[model samples]
Target chain A: MRSKRALRYGLLGLSAALIGVGLLRQEHLEVLGKAVRICLECVGIG
Target chain B: MSGMRRNRIKWPLSRQRTIQLISAALVNGYIAGFQKGRIFTGGTKAVCVPVLNCYSCPGALGACPIGALQTAVGGVKHHFPFYVLGLLMLFGVLLGRAVCGLLCPFGLVQDLLHKIPSPKVRVPKGLDRPARGIKYVVLLVFVILLPAFAVTETRVTPPYFCQYICPAGTLGGGIPLMLADPALRQLAGWLFNWKVLVLVVIAAASVLIHRPFCRYLCPLGAFYALFNRFSFFQMSLDAHKCVGCGACERVCPMAVEVTKDINSPECIRCGACQTACPTGAIAGPLKKQSPR
Candidate 1:
């Protein structure tokens, strides 16, 4: 039970840290730029 | 064979089903864009949702984690997808495939279609076990490998999964855009036709099989399955309450052996097993505990 909880919260912490790294790097802006455009490929045009 | 799978319940709108509908609505909340034939271009669009909703869907308020991952992987400017991967990891750590069972719009579509009352088909375990691995293959080959390594003639990396395979793209993104704009219809070609064919097959298959796409093709579900075993909200089976009645296994949509492995990756956390367990052996945080 202890190990399980540790693994669960450990991964959660790692996820939060990665998100911080991503934001500091402005990777969300890249997602924003792609998402704002009507991705024709996603519309099955490609 | 699936006579008492889930349709017969204490209430018409079960808690999971209600959450599914509400999540779908909230994920695709920009309803005006659906009529206007335009995608939402707001700050919220940067945020990634945990489901397989297509970003091209006119009403989508946020990007799909899978789609955003592929886009970032395929981007020339953005070499790595820290944001999308982080978001996906966060969702998986939190809920695992409960996101599929309780939140995915495409999962809701499959569940509704599977309710159409037909002779259900269950694939033999010999084939089904092998078939389940296809989604992981899709995640590796289409979502990751092709985007990161396979360069097109123009030196641009295409999101191969969305362009060539995603049926959600056809139903939620392609069809609506085609209906809304003449130019998009004119633009539709062999790829669009292929997508429609894929959608039709999945739709027909859904009537006879529960979540064939999620079980066999959804890369998003595959990604979440990795975290299912240790995810925070996984169901716990009470050995003391279990009478080995085998009720839970029979109703499992994913064919999981509920008594043996209630927290299996294939178990969508849809509560069918919990509902079917006569002794209430299979209870989760979502379920009420019986007094000892």
Candidate 2:
């Protein structure tokens, strides 16, 4: 993969990892939202 | 027939449309998946959407950022919405309503509705700024103060903005939920009818006005405005490259004066200016970048 795309994927992975931890530890509405928020933040709104 | 020159017909395919669709899909998908589980277990935490979506809407996965913040401010406890504010700032620092342009499903829906061939209203400048402030009042008063003071419970409820005004809730979650479940339908009353009326009016207005709700009534948009000055993913106009032709402003559906400053709170980073500029003066990051 191109370096930029690869780097983007890496960042995505890291964010997902962090969000997954947040979600697993707290199943509450506010906690689950952390996962989606993280995904959008990393993706940069397409 | 003589050899006559034929005009090439170009298809209208803007990258903005692609972005809006993708964001909507992701948010909607998450909301659908989230309903199976409960989000609030004990404490009040904030969930924020980068775009102006409603939190109470059944399909919403993340708490509406504006809603959460308002509720926090409005609820009797009146605590700072650290998570919601932080999350909103995170996106604002990164995308700057590149979220509104590309990812907001509701914004996309409005855009699609505006596509209908019809007479449209270009809100005059005299009324525009004042109109934009309404959402802020919503953010401050309805979402924040009311819940903080008016509630029976000490915990903050989702702000009234989502409950009464968010068209996204009416169109995305309300309509669908009512259609799918009899229990939800039975629960519907004058309040539901009122929401439906509001949605219908907004939907109709969208055909004539480009993103009327985003232009005037989205508190989430107001929050993003605070970060536009330094957002990493933004349309920067190299003043040297910009000839001040005002082409960007002319094409902007939101009617933002792009060359005045790249950091205008009103700018949605729709990339219209980038395409419109003959000098290639405008550009945005393909991915979120660390703020400068």
Candidate 3:
């Protein structure tokens, strides 16, 4: 039981750390760039 | 009238249904975009919502995570999808398939459709078990592999799931945009027809079966399912309180074996099992219980 709790919090910390690194690298800018446009494919025009 | 009563949705609707409606509305909150037939171009577009919404939905306030993941990974630069994966992981660790049960817009659509009073078709356990595995394969092949490696002549890979499958996009983004814009209608082709067909089949299937897409093909659900066993929000069965009546199994929409595997990867944390259990042995998806 203690191990399970440790594993859960361990993953939480890992994900938060990953997010921090991604922000430092500006990876969200890539997501924003693609998202701000009208994605014709998502509209089923592809 | 009888059918409505049978579904027990005639009165003040359930808490989960209300949350689903509110969440769907807020997630697609740029209402003026629907009127003008244009996608939202705000900074919030950079953020990804946990549920499987469409970036092309004119009213979408945020990017679809799966779409963002595909685009970020499939780009010529291909620096890896750390941000998207982190966000998805965070959501999974927090809510697991409770996101599917109480938050996903497409999940809400299926729930409403299934309430249409048609004859329910119970998928055989043998077939159902295998079919459930297809969503993981979809996550591996379409959302991950194809997007990462299937580069086109144009030097980019398409979001295969969004383009080829994903009835949510076809319904929420494609059809609405197609309906509101006459000029865009001229561009409709075989692909558009194919997407519309996919939406039709899924919608039709929802009337007879519960969450066929979530069970068999949703890559987001597949991704989240991996974290279900340890997600903060979950269902718990009290073996001490349980009488092994099997009532929970009979009522489960996703066909989970509640007594043995209440936190199974397929369990959506919908709490129907909790509601169905006669012995008060089941706990919540949201309620925190001390480790027993």
Of the candidates shown, which would achieve the greatest TM-score relative to the real structure? Answer: 1
Over the full model, what C-alpha lDDT does candidate 3 score relative to the true structure?
0.87
Top model number, lDDT:
1
Q: For residues B125-242, could you state the per-residue lDDT of candidate 1 as single tens digits?
A: 9999999999999999999999988876766688999988899988998999899999999989998898899999999998888899999999999999999999987898889988
Q: Name the regions of candidate 2 deviating beyond 4 angstroms.
A: A1-46, B1-12, B30-47, B55-61, B70-78, B153-158, B286-292
How many angstroms is residue B183 displaced in model 1 relative to the true structure, after the best TM-score fit? 1.4
Against the native complex, each candidate's DockQ, computed on alpha carbons, is 0.87, 0.05, 0.81
> For candidate 3, lDDT tens digit of each residue in B1-292?
0123234464586677888999999999999989998889999988899999998898899999999988878887766788999999999999999999999999999998888876688899999999999999999999889988888888788889898998988888998899899988889899899999999999999888889999999999999999999988868777888888899998888999888998999998777777777777888854433343
Cα lDDT tens digits for candidate 2, B126-231: 9887898887776667666776666655364545666677667666556655665566667677767777888889889888777888888777777777666656
How many angstroms is residue B266 displaced in model 1 relative to the true structure, after the best TM-score fit? 0.8
After superposing candidate 1 on the true structure, give the runs of residues whose Cα lies further than 4 Å from its correct spot: B1-11
Q: What is residue B116's positional error in candidate 1, in angstroms?
A: 0.9
Please state the error at residue B50 of candidate 1 in Å: 0.6
